[model samples]
Target: MTLSWSDPMFRSIVWQVVIIGGFAAIAWYLVSNTSTNLKARRIATGFEFLGRTAGIPIGEHMIDYEPSINTYGYALFVGVLNTLKVSVVGVVLATLLGTLIGILRLSRNWLISKLTASYVEVLRDIPLLLQLLFWYTVLQGLPAARQSFNPVPGVFLSNRGVKLPALNWEAPHLWALAAFVLGCVATHYVGKRADRIQDATGVRPRVWPVALGLLIAVPVAVWAALGAPWSIEWPVLRGFNFQGGLTVSPEYFALLLGLVIYTSAYVAEIVRSGILSVPHGQIEAGGALGLRQGVILRKIILPQALRVIIPPMTSQYLNLTKNSSLAVAIGYQDMVSIANTTLNQTGQAIEGIFMIGLLYLVISLSISLFMNWYNARVALVER
Candidate 1:
């Protein structure tokens, strides 16, 4: 009747059941409490409120939205587009600036390295909100429209906003944009082909020339063939204010600048660390094999360092995107800003906050998923 080793299967099954049951019990308890509290507060939850009219003006809506006609759902969609616009531009600009500064920090020239280090320290030490406030103040303090600073004939800078000539795009502009997209896709495939050819044969294909031809040449050719039916609408300083050009509001500019500079500092550090993580032996070996410095960096270092750089860069991007919520302080009409306004106007605090949280969560999760996929693609394998 003594216990035997052959009875191990029964014990394992009992433990597994106990562990799962415990987790399920905890989950049920939490949900039950949440629902009870919500009911006690007389709060009805779900997505029905999304259909209600959002009688609020969104200053910078990407889509044509009317305060009287559009629903909360449409307002939220506009907010989403604005958030994406800022985030995408910020990510691209930050990456470029950060990579340049990161490389400079490691430069052989002492002046360049020290200058870059100082830049990283100074920018990172300042609070992002303060920087945004400062930029906004500066923009607000500029001269009036009559004395607006015009660097070029059509571009006017003033307290009101930055005004620049815009293209009145006809059908040809759309065709050009389509051609540009196709050119980018073609260049990507061409790059892959070049790499494969280089790997298979000792001869390196001229990837940059081919890429330039596809990206610039093809797009220009298509644009020209379509008659280039676009005209520039110049800004003219009339009696009171500037007119006839696309104006970038001070709120938008300040938010964009602050996000870019603040995030670039963190991105710079990530890039520097990633580059440093590449073993010195690799560089030395490349040099020993008679490869030039530029060739070594482009061909050997970047591919390896990208694996280290991409994850932290992704985090910085997500941080910048979330930080855009601070636009509420400066009246940027971003998602958080619009949602806060809605909450105050409608007194639907729970619904407004839920929508805001959901939007941010979705954006963060999407970025994380993309970064995870990229990381998997570039991760080193060990046999």
Candidate 2:
């Protein structure tokens, strides 16, 4: 028996097949045209160019890289790492700062509310690129190495960069790190158990104190047992510069500053909206039940607010990751920057573009997937 056109299921299946077939046909046409164009121009295409030596110098790299020794593929990998580093750090810092500002925006104090509002308006209104340029210029205009700003004995700042004392780690540090990881896992279980107990009984267990003991006290105890396998290596003034410390270059600083500041503005708005989306009656209800302000916020407001907050927050995170491509403007060696160099050097525009797009697609999808999962967990379950 044939399915009737009037049937909703039959119509739905027909529409889906038509859409899929159309997409497939378009994809085939595009791919065929790209191949034909490459062939016509006698241009070589493949991933073999990745193995060739990249003779260009890069300012900053997390991994061991030398222009004379490493391949183009390695350079691309370094770029990916740099992008991830900035994106991760920017996301964390932005979220924290933005959340604070958002909370302050709703403050009972007039000064705080006005100040936060002004900050949000200023940051979001200014173009991110211009802000980056301004920061870079300001950093570059700082005093020279000889007249460097010394905020603390071991910390120095100048036109060159900011240098802080570096931690020298020993083998035992690994064991300390392992202990810290174990403590974190224990804390997570403890928190879950606390929540379960709270649900079963009317009394909520105080998990923060226990969590702090596990996460912080246990780590400290492990570190002491391991003979504190670390030393601070302070920056010392060499002939014209500071040496032997952790350095933050101006380019990286500018990029990070701009990303955090700009993204935080948007995040503040998202957070404010999320918090406001929660019904005021909920707060009054909590107060009626003899709950303290902090408890009400923690147990009620945040859980509900986070469900609204996470989806848009995910978009902001992805935007920050993608906007890291702006690192090229400030001479930061991010993925897009390195890929641009590769494309120019080898004249492999297609490959470079494809790689950059693929990397971004993977990153965006990963963030979306994670946020979606978290949102689902915290979301309201309706019967």
Name the candidate that leads on TM-score. 2
User: lDDT value for candidate 2?
Assistant: 0.92
List where candidate 2 sits over 4 angstroms from the true fold.
Answer: 2-22, 195-209
Cα displacement (Å) at residue 50, model 1: 2.0
Clashes (N, CA, C under 3 Å) per candidate: 0, 0
Lowest summed-lDDT stretch of 10 residues in model 1?
A: 1-10
RMSD of each: 3.1, 2.3
- Clashes in candidate 2: how many? 0
- lDDT tens string, model 2, 299-356? 8999989988999999999999999999999888999999999999998899999999
Residue range 156-225, candidate 1, lDDT tens digits = 8898889999999788778878888998999899989888998899787888988888888888888899
* lDDT of candidates 1 onward, in order: 0.87, 0.92
Question: What is the RMSD, in Å, between candidate 2 and the native fold over all Cα?
Answer: 2.3
